[model samples]
Target: MIQITNLHKSYKTGSNSLHVLKGINFSVKEGELVSIMGSSGSGKSTLLNILGMLDEADTGSYVLDGVTIKNLNEKQAARYRNKFLGFIFQSFNLISYKSALDNVALPLYYQGMARGERMDRAMAYLEKVGLADWSGHLPNQLSGGQKQRVAIARALASDPKVLLADEPTGALDTKTSYEVMDLIQQINDEGRTILVVTHENDIAHMTKRIVNLKDGLIIEDTPVQQVRALENV
Candidate 1:
């Protein structure tokens, strides 16, 4: 579960400050699948950074899974991020030289997991994402969707409390995007909290809830019938 109240953030440009998030209040419950929809300069990225702990809000409170997130040193912040959040980026963010299996195991290695245990866990996640057979393939060797699947497996290998995906389906074709979304939905069904940041309307619709942002404000937050991606694909 996550909660942020009256969040405000700003950045300086020369002498002027551009406010990114203003008096925003939002929360995502455990096991919920939510999407944040916004245009360029809509502050969705700022919000995501704050939520992902990549950047802290200038003011307000963020609590993740019962831990208050504020004023932490980089070391502390990194620890919390590694322990509680998994990230899937649009570009997949895989190392070009690392094989899919090693890519998935990277986080666990950072966490100081033993080699044998981490590899086992990584392989399990690869299988979970239907990429077991491609475990030895490098990112360059896989197709766009398969690369994304490898990213998803990497995210899950940490077994974090929440998955924060930024434009998860943005890089793939419609069919591939739906396939990835289907995997995400299945993950949510198993009780992992997920928050997707996307600009596509159809992508937002795939989630159970949509939070619309504009000019650094949450203009709309609504729950709707979930669009089953597997059915559509």
Candidate 2:
């Protein structure tokens, strides 16, 4: 569902330029769960940002679900991003005052969905994530895993084509992390295209494929035997 070729990205720092991604190439098919693995300064976040259309590449080609992604105006990019992409961040990005239900309903609000319909959709996703009973709870009221589950529900409420997760499970204890990963694996098994950006080996192993990045380039891309997080949990 994603294709990239000769992707290059750089940032100017004073008089010097820091190259972030160099000659990156890869493709993710529909229904695949992939992880981008790298250490600090390895360009994984840069690649994920480009893939999510949150940032533009200096040069290269990116096609998402048959649409070429390049040179779009801000309005056009936002429209496409809303229609095709969903994101989960490590920070949970929820408004402090918003309840879990309200948080999940926020994206549908941006889509111009009416309150009644949006609430119904958001509740359905919250139910799917096993958080229906906690709908009235705020982020601070929930545990880290519960907050991440709310975030996952929010990400899915829009029904986007691909899910882009950055450091999912990074902040939780081992058991909670495994529980979150189990949910993610279940989502992928149901045919959602997911790309997780993470540095943890166990986290990467939970995905079907791992793309290792080093010094702004992909050093290794390979499929591996999947590790079921449920077993670990």
Candidate 3:
């Protein structure tokens, strides 16, 4: 459902140009669960940002679910993101002042969903993530795993075409990380497309396919024997 070709990205630092992604190419089909693995300077984040439409490539093409993604005005990009993309970050990215339910409902609010319906939809997603009982709790009131569950609920509330999770389990303990990954696998089992950006080898193995990045290029791409996270959980 996503395609990129010969992608290139560079950033200017003082007088030097730092190339983050060079000649990157990959495609993700619908219903696929993939991981992009890389180190700190490996350009995985840059690739995810381009896919997430949070940033643009300096060159090459990107097409998402049949729509060409280039030169989009801020309004257009935001509309596309709300309509077709869901994001999960390692930091949870929840508003501290908002309750778990409100945080999940935020995207629908931006879509102009009515108060009652958006809330109902958000609650359903929270239920899916096994956090319905904690809907009234604020972020600080929840444990790290609970907060990530809330974040996952918020991501799913939009029913977007693809879920882009950046270091989804980075901040969790081993057991909690596996639990979160188990939840992700369950989502993928239901045929949702997902791309996880992570550097952890164990985390990457949980995905159906792993794409390794080094020095801004895809150095390896292979399908692995999927390590079921549920087994660990």
Candidate 4:
């Protein structure tokens, strides 16, 4: 579903150029759940941004769901991203004043979905995330895990082909983290491609495959079981 080759990205810092991604290469098949594990300043978020089409790569190729994204214009990129990707972030990125349902419905509204249809879809996803009863609660009223569930519902409400999550369980307690991870696993089981970026090894292990990154390059990419087995050797 997603193919990237020799991807490179850099930022200009006055007279010096800071390289954020150095020829990264990987492919994520449709319905596969992949985790990217990296330390701070390791370019995981930069990679996620590129994958989400929020930022363009400086060089190399990226074909997402059969569409090449390197040269897409802003409007074209936005259209592809809106139609093909959903995002969950650690910060819960919800509007403070909006209720859970309203937050979930926002993306559909951006896509010009009819109000009735969007609300229905939002409510359905909220129910899937076990937040249906809390639809009227605003962000501030919900606990961290609850807010994260609302974010997950919001992500799914778009019905996108790929889910890109950045540190999704970072802010929650262990139990809540596991609960959220279980929801992510369930979502992946339903045939959606999930790529999560996290610094936590345990969280990364929850996914089928983990890609370890350091100094802007993938150092190891393996199934989670293999990683654990090797660690125990």
lDDT of each: 0.94, 0.94, 0.95, 0.90
What TM-score do all the candidates reach, one by one?
A: 0.99, 0.99, 0.99, 0.94
Best-matching candidate per lDDT: 3
Candidate 1, which segments miss by more than 4 Å at Cα? none
Show where candidate 3 strays beyond 4 Å. none
Tens-digit per-residue lDDT, 1-233, candidate 3? 99999999999999999999999989999999999998899999889999988899999999999999999999999999999999999999999999999999999999999999999999999999999999999999999999999999999998999999999999999999999999999999999999999988999999999999999999999999999997876
RMSD to truth, every model: 0.7, 0.7, 0.7, 3.4
Give the range of the ten consecutive residues with the poorest summed lDDT in model 1. 224-233
lDDT of 4 at 82: 86
* Candidate 1 lDDT tens digits, 36-140: 998999999999999988899999999999999999899998999999999999999999999999999999999999999999999999999998999999899
Which candidate model has the greater TM-score, 2 or 4? 2
Error of 1 at 4 (Å): 0.4
Of the pair 3 and 4, which is ahead by TM-score? 3
Clashing residue pairs in all predictions, respectively, total 0, 0, 0, 0
Candidate 3 CA-lDDT value: 0.95
- Candidate 3 worst ten-residue window by lDDT: 224-233
- Candidate no. 4 TM-score: 0.94
